[model samples]
Target: MGRRYDRLIGSLVGTCAAFAASPAAAATAGAPHLDGAEMGLIWVVPFVAILLSIALFPLFAPEFWHHHFGKVAAACAAAFLVPFLVVHGVSLTIYEVVHVSLLEYLPFIILLLALFTVAGGIRLRGSIIGTPAVNTGFLLFGTLLASWTGTTGAAMLLIRPVIRANEWRRYKVHTIVFFIFLVANIGGSLTPLGDPPLFLGFLKGVSFFWPTQHMFLPMVVAATVLLAVYFAIDSTLFRREAPRPSDEASEETFGIDGKINILLLAGIVGAVLLSGIWKPGIAFDIYHVQLELQGLVRDVLLLLITFLSWKLTSRENREANGFSWFPIIEVGKLFAGIFLTIIPAIAILKAGTGGALGSVVSLVTNDAGEPVDTMYFWLTGLLSSFLDNAPTYLVFFNTAGGDPAALMGPFASTLLAISAGAVFMGANTYIGNAPNFMVKAIAEERGIAMPSFFGYMLWSVGILIPIFVLITFLFFH
Candidate 1:
């Protein structure tokens, strides 16, 4: 244990030391940034390693994973940073690290933490049966709720209730899988409030109602198909399982405890909306990274909300809900690794036809450079299924010509492709979006084996890919 602790500390020190070596170099001439055009494919290996680690370790080495997953995360982060430090030197490395940590990672985790805390406090009290109708209704409600409260908010709020509803069922993995599909991912397509990527678009001058106007049809198609399919699978499983005597015998009433948290969830939505709408036009410069006043306000407000929710709810309040901080901690640590290591990948993709993945960039256009909406959809989606969907959306948004009016008018279909791809295909993997991981963790905590990472992909690849293909034919093509 001591050695493991020492190793973890070493990993942390190594990663941090590189970034800290030259704080005063923020104004270094030439801007000292990573030229993704010069970087090769090797820079992305660390990101791939972490993905494989998350997928394989739990399945093949559960004991080691449960014991030292944080250390593994730290080591993977170091593997990326230490090498980049050697190649780029401390100045550029520090700039890139601070850039992402402050502007991207911090905001990402803060929003998630706020939603998780507030949602965890809202305990649904009842012996809701695991009947097909009940489970389907829960998912439908969560899907509708996601676009308003945020996917993290919706998923965190109802995952426990949904799990509690189905605890008695033997064939229940399918329910959680479909919940991820419709509720956590596809459901977030209606507005910027729905998901981080859409919110990023909102910040980038995409109109508030743009997603609602354009993405509504695609979101409806995906949700309706998945919900219907989930209902059928669950119904068949419901009939196959041996019915317990108390399944229908108990006349349990449904109710909610810690009802105040319902209001806090709304506060969360307001705080996020305020960040987008109530821009105060002030800024803070943290080591050359620009921090806007509205952003800081949103983050602080969210933290305060999280604290209030914790204090307002009693210990028993959350205990009854089976709410634990483990899921959030697990997501925070693993995503810290994911975000840090993915720096190069985002940079490379952002470089367009000059980076190592130029062939990928070239695919979205033809010899005449016309925007092929179909390729935009598939590429953005396939990349988003692995990379952080927010930046992936930004990359393709810029690729489609970053002028909002033009994209919203002349290139409307192209913008729709990018938006739908990022928002919907996030359901393609547990790591594809923040909420997916949280939902998986919470479900597993309730003793659902869920699926192994690749095992889960089997579900996504078999189920979601076809849906996306159908969407392509119906819309993008």
Candidate 2:
């Protein structure tokens, strides 16, 4: 792994230098911006390749992918950068790289790291028998907690308990799948801290409580329906299965260990809120990407919070929780490539009527140039199912007109559609959200048999799709 990582880094550095010295680098210093309208569909190959590598590689080549996924991600990024350099020149390539790194990837990974670290430190000390009612309670608790601790954080905190409770059950895959639906995705729709896409909206000048106010009804409806469905299914499954002999030995009471981490989790939330609310209007420009004072402060504080959790928490606490760094590392590496390769797609989407994907933009607007709420909901949700939701949300947000004030006011329904789509539809696939994969990884490690990529899609299509359709009719329409 070390050798592969080194080679990948070396290749990237060499590629950057080679492009920097090309004649086109100097010639295009002041040329007009590269028009997305002029680009062909072929430019999107690397992006597609990276997404395919993520979805297919783990299922087919688990051993090789586990060891060298980072290398694969780096290579995919280089695939985009190489051709991008040839066509757009070195300066633009460098700018885009620096821009994504500073504006998107760094802040994203930092928050995930903080949440993963802090949540991993805290362990649920007691276990319960996997009763249908108890399982429903856990799902409900996680759904509410997700809006506060983050979907990733809440999923990490509760998944182990859920798995342990159901370890002896023969039909438990459904439990884990529903956990992913509510805890890992849909439950995060109500707050910026709940999901990265909403946090990006907050950074773009949307108010901190805007999601809470606008998304409350949709979130409540989704969570209630999922919980009710889960309870009914679990009750039926419980009746068909015999009780485990060891179930009697497990404790009925629940308690939390590593309590300090709760304070740290709160600190993580406070840090995020502070960054959004305490902006001093100070910023430093690095390669045309603006790093704001509050953002830098927030990143530093998050790092400190992560470090303190690592230092203060007992090793036993983490071990009991089955904590490892691999999940976050996987997310960090894969999303780095995602953030890089997505540049062209976002640019093309931003080009509106002039780009190759102009039809997509046209689909969400009416003949009179008005944004259609249902189209915004489904289009944003569908794209977010395949692409990373944060950038997908940004694309549609801009498509709906990127004014925070307007989005919060007269265009509030459109903003709500975009938010609900990005957050809820992320459950449509395992790769839709970062924690979805992490939860699957941890479950598989605990000896639970998770579904394959397409198998999981079947669950989403049967369950979540109908719920979304209802949402479209009830709210979006």
Candidate 3:
């Protein structure tokens, strides 16, 4: 764990790096700056409780959770807000709320909504045989498609097609499991729109293509290996399974419905890219939070694009695709709590050794005080595997140094570690990423006896972990 330390310190010297920032210099730089150093660990309890509730409630109380999850989220959010308002005053509370909501949560959910809406409308209408090669092709194509369509969108779009192809086979659990690993999680690494955590990075000032540039190699490496492995396993399973009966074979030609949504998806991409590249320089203040014209335009355009896609597509297309609003609604409600509760966690991590999460700093740093890339990878990843990855990513991003310029420069590797960890390790569990559970639920609905929570981990633990180790050696190490 001992590093030369100079590299880390050098990284810190750049543009207010997060963890490396001097206690005086960093201190969570922002308006009405929250002094994380002054806040006790108790302040973090709500964040922890909310994440735990997300992880636990569905397992223990599916009925109550299904009906009342939104209320639970609001209660957890109030757990922090009520206390903060009382202690910090209405003005500061309002600023924090407005800042986070306007800058982070709103853009995030909007982007997800646009992608989900657009991709949901486009339905694959034809049938294809699920040979080993065809199955591998589905996975690889979804992996490629995920960066443009959000993981949720990509997974939702292709999963049914993949399942339909494989339904004739008796043994295809491995195919679905690998589908979760690649299409739902790892595939989203290449672009901000691909994953929530990366989008948070983009919102924080990481360029739209920063991930594409820096993350491409690692993504390609992991994807190549996983795809190769999937091909081998799938081929073996295909051999073992009995041949499809003549009646079960696909007689339908492959086609797609709602093809116009493809253009709309492009529109969504253009809107997001415009927000990043076009700085109109005009801005407005909303309760101490600065809102830019470009961002405003981007959001409005996204909403318009969502409207156009929904209006243009037939209800029949979405119904055939088995599209439902529940997944996105669940994400919106749950992440509302996540984004709110994570405020202090980000602040504390930004405060470094001076904050409640000081030990976190120690764990990811060497004795010489350099950031350890490997530890960052594992910790961020393992945490993301269990807790929600987006917040797990934000915590580590601030911990490294919240400054985008510095992180993109000297601490680039650290940011890469955090990014890869959050996106990749999300495949480790059903709850790790939003799409994981959705994909699992969909598979079960299709009559696949998907692994139980722990049962699924057997696939992840046996396959994904070793791949992660190779990734560490290839990049993070």
Candidate 4:
């Protein structure tokens, strides 16, 4: 009789334990599908836009047909294409958490301010270096400079000079492709501010110093390889253009008269600092209010800065440089298609997390059967070359968190993969990096014929991919 009663009590406790565990496992299960849904939208929107733009761009601007349309148009098409599809397809969960509110939009505004400041700074100096021998120098210097001034600043400062130097050359496409690889992509590996992924890591628990210190060797190696490779390719192209009579006259000095634009730029930076220091309080009820206030002030200041930069700069300088709103306008025209198309894909990623992903995501095991964190940085880096590096970084960034024990692994090694992958792989295609589009637009505005979308990838897949694999093996593994 006593044994029977004890068995009844044991069964009751087991039932209660099962009930408690069920809710947690259930919550974890629902997360992955939701993630997939969210990411799926990113892909869908851009694809639709690609179809629409093929019809729309020519209809709207028939004159665009007469000059080289394939380069800029294909690039713009990609700016709308790759990021939208890849982000939509990844099934990341972060967006799901912030989906209901405007806080998710905060980063976009920050990017806008940051990008504008970068653009404004570019407008000031234009390009300082000319090419062939100096082209590789610009690439190396720009990569180092990216760590401090931001990749956008480095890209903007160097692009014009590179373009001008190669302006007389027929084979300018290789120059821009290498520029995207080094200046736009691998250059940002050192700092959080340098790349969005490291910045996101900063917002999480990772230290700023950690990534920079660990990444230095790889950065130096990659920069050196890229410079050597760029010089070789550039030399070959240079010889081809050289046999023909040089139509281009070298400019002695190109000077800027608009110094006040610098002050306006300082104001934009000040606005960002102000917002950071005076973050709004977030109560459950009023969470978005703070984000709204900060965003409004940030954007308003950007508007003022844009106006002042335009107003203070001399008209002759603008025309002499052939400066127009075309670059910005081009960026604006193309990203709308990207933004609209990727929304649904992100939804799918959010909806499908954990439920469908468990089989696909697992640890690498040693011969002894000890589990290790999978080498995600490799594939994530590769995918980033095709997708928008930011969302690609986020999806894998979250995925790397599975076993708490994994954090005990080398911080430098792990974050190196994540940071390096995101920054470096951005050069995989023209659209992989934000500055790639801006640089391409700037080049085309100056009348250089850049490559088509696939053409740019051919350069990357052929040259950059092998270098990245060497990097991963030498350092990351």
Candidate 5:
């Protein structure tokens, strides 16, 4: 499957090159500005196709998908690029590719890679049982750590231990699902370091502690509710499952190997902060995309840290942790396609009332042009659930008027809604955030029977949706 997909990609690339070199195609050389208002909804077919591929392919054709998933991603990217190049010309196509790759995809993948590699090196060497109290404590610790180490970092670091602790239990799927909800998603709402959306907000002139100030109560309420609910469900499941002979000796010892990786994790966090704070303003232009010095420095440092972690940690540590590269690789390939196909969708949303999706823009505004906070909450969240949350947050942040001072002041609730929606609702689906997929991959690799894509949505819709509704009235409204 992999080879077949590679051949198809090669053929597509050859065709594109030949077409571009043709006299007629060469004549259409200049870049044309794209107006989302003029674009028909049909342009979104590739995006929808890619999304469906992510959702349905795994369920319908497991073997084919497992092998050729990257190829499917590449095909979906080409589906958009080919027509896009024909319509918008070579210059704009090049710009779009470079723009998304340099500005969005590279940094995103690098951060995740660093976190995954560093966290994978750390193994908790302990004989802890997965009692209800122990499980709840692990979840709570992960939830707190997420704000500091990032959702990806925290999830990667703790997921293995959680799975190991509960390896004896038969009904343990709920524990993993709740882990996705709380540790991988909601737990990252407190600080800019917690989630990508908030970090993007920070880079867009929001203060470092702004999210802490605005999102604290909502985050506390959401996490507390989730933790309480998870405890109840897990306790019941625990009672149903018969205890193993090993469970008779309840006392257990706990220690951590690969402790140096914890410092590397801190280095990762510091590197991110340095990029935001120490902007040198120097940039190199690559095909019209500006690669800033600070960002490049951060990426390089992250790579270095990843290498150091790999070299320092023993092979036994990774083996014990059940660490593998498949999870990160899967995330990297799938998101490459997602970032590319999402370009037009973002442009349409950016076009506001003038764009193809004007009605969507209108949903957050009342007849008097007043910003409706509740609508902002739901719309931003619903979109973030499908679209990548960081960019979605930025879109609504700009839509609500992009002045940080204004947003933090008069439109405080609006900003809060956008922040909460992007971070909180990312739990709604597997692809809603990067870590969500990584956690799912790791859990499945550990032999846990994860739900189908739609099955997981049922869990989110049933659990998270109601909590969000309550939040809408209690806060955003």
Candidate 6:
């Protein structure tokens, strides 16, 4: 009992120290900023409430989290603002560095929602893609495909089928856990499209193909280890199933409506690419015209594809899969909160990387001839689990910019380290990654209660962390 108390105190002290030493803990060099206590009140108060809403309030306010995620997210925003005001005392100076209008991260959040909604709508009936035989194969495909479709896209495509194939198993959390470990995190380490950090590198003059090269080996190693572990765990759980009735067997069916929905999806991608390529050719430089066009095209494509998928796919498939926008809506609502609440935190990070905070070595070379960054990749990845990986990636990218080694060969190794850290570690907690909470909410909507935030961490510590440590020592180090 005394040891436990001591451990708790040590944890609190460590947290306080981390907060005090955080690069974003202070204001820009020239400006006056809030003291540690004031910053603590703003960030910590709302953070504690979020933890309460997630872990404790569910006991009393059964519907509270689902019904009021927007409120909670907004409360976080208010927390950030109130302290900003207290520090500045009604001055407009806060506006110069922290712009509330910089809430441009919203559309990307929406894009994730729409993208997942479409993925959730797709299900296969006795399809090869959804079969247990193809489990390892599809996972690899999804992992490789992530660079093009995005990590969330690959996860959405693969998760349902993984669940379907393992439906008969009683101990199925193992499957979901492994799925989160691989499909959601490790699979997306190869390219900018696969994960957000690589995307930031692309925007900053790193070639599109750079991350893919370096990430290949690490990704291969991680995937191999995870697949082997999954197979062993799954083998232990796989049991003989009682035969289903003939009528139940005959009832199952699946197919896409036509090729149109697929075509529509293709068109959206093409339009986005064209918008990006043609931006420089246009007379007026409308900011993010590519993004605007891409969004417009994407929504139109999704609507058309959704209709086609509904009309073309078998009615039985729809019946078996009953419709619910709740999953997507829940993601929408929850992400709204995450987007708003974390904006200031991200802004602070960006500000610090832009010279508000003092400079520190972002990267270092280890004994194994591998280059590693302290602030650049590891920290970016650590935060990416809880925050948006995109912004997290940007923080590191911005920090590493202008450093010579950042420009050269085998940069993908560093990129892979960053990507693995961000994508995989997100499974450490329910809120670690956007998809973790969204997936949990979706599963619960389907009547499967995922582990709590800390409960999930047990898996990370016992199983995943050891794997990560191996990765760090063997591959990344």
Top candidate on lDDT is 3
TM-scores across all candidates?
A: 0.82, 0.87, 0.93, 0.64, 0.83, 0.66
Q: Candidate 1: give the clashing pairs.
A: none
Alpha-carbon lDDT, every model: 0.73, 0.76, 0.79, 0.52, 0.74, 0.47
Instruction: Compare candidates 2 and 4 on lDDT and give the better one.
Output: 2
Query: Which residue pairs collide, candidate 5?
Result: none
**Model 5 scores what on Cα lDDT?**
0.74
In the range 1-477, model 1's lDDT, one tens digit per residue, is 111111110001011101111211123344566667788999888877876676556546767876787899899899999999998898878888776676656666677677667776886767778799999899999999888767766776688778877777799999999998888888888887787777656655577788999999999999999989999999999999887666344465788888888898889878877876776667667666666787788889999999999999988988876666755666567767866887776567657788897787788888887889999998888877765466567667766655666887988999899999988887887767666766676777678998987899999999999999999999987
Error of model 6, residue 219, in angstroms? 2.1
Better of 3 and 6 by lDDT: 3
lDDT of 1: 0.73
Q: Report the number of clashing residue pairs per model.
A: 0, 0, 3, 49, 0, 3
With candidate 3 superimposed using the best TM-score fit, by how many Å does residue 354's alpha carbon deviate from the native? 1.0
- Which regions of candidate 3 fall more than 4 Å away from where they truly are? 1-30
State the lDDT of candidate 6 residue by residue for 369-472, as single tens digits. 34464334456556655544544454444333322135544464555555566666655655454445444444555555567767777877788767767778
Backbone clash total, candidate 4: 49
Query: Roughly what TM-score does model 1 have, to 2 decimal places?
Result: 0.82
Q: Write the per-residue lDDT of candidate 5 for residues 1-477, one digit (tens) a residue.
A: 121111110000000101111111112234334566677777777777876676556546767877988899899999999999998888878877776677666766677677768877877766778988999999999889888777876776788889888887898888988998888888888876778777656645566678888898998889889889999999888889985876454454788889999899889888977877776767776764566788799899999999999999999888877677766666677767866876776667656788877787788888987789998899889977865566567668767755676887888999999999988998898767666766676777789989977899999999999999989999976
Clashing pairs in 3: 17-401, 18-401, 19-400
Q: Can you give the lDDT of residue 448 in candidate 4?
A: 76
lDDT of 4 by residue, 1-477 (tens): 111111010000000001011111122333333334223233445434443443333335535522333344455446644563465444432333232123322333344444444344343344343457877777787787666545665676567767766665677777787787777767877765566555445433355555678778888888889888889887877776655344445445665455565566556556655544554743222311222455457557767776666666667755544444433433333333333333443333333334334332453223453323226666667656555565555555544542212532543455567667777777776556567755766777788787777777777778877887788678756
> Which lDDT tens digits does candidate 2 get at residues 1-477?
121111110001000111111111122234225566777777767777876776556657777887888899899889888899998998778777776676566777787778778877988867687899989999999999888877877887899889888888898999999998999888887777788788767756677789999899999998899999999999999999986885357655789988999999899888988987785877776665566788799999999999999999999889887677766667678778877876776667667778887887899989998889999999888877765566678678767766777889998999999999988998898767666766777788788899988899999999999999999999988
C-alpha RMSD for every candidate: 6.0, 6.2, 7.4, 14.8, 7.1, 9.0
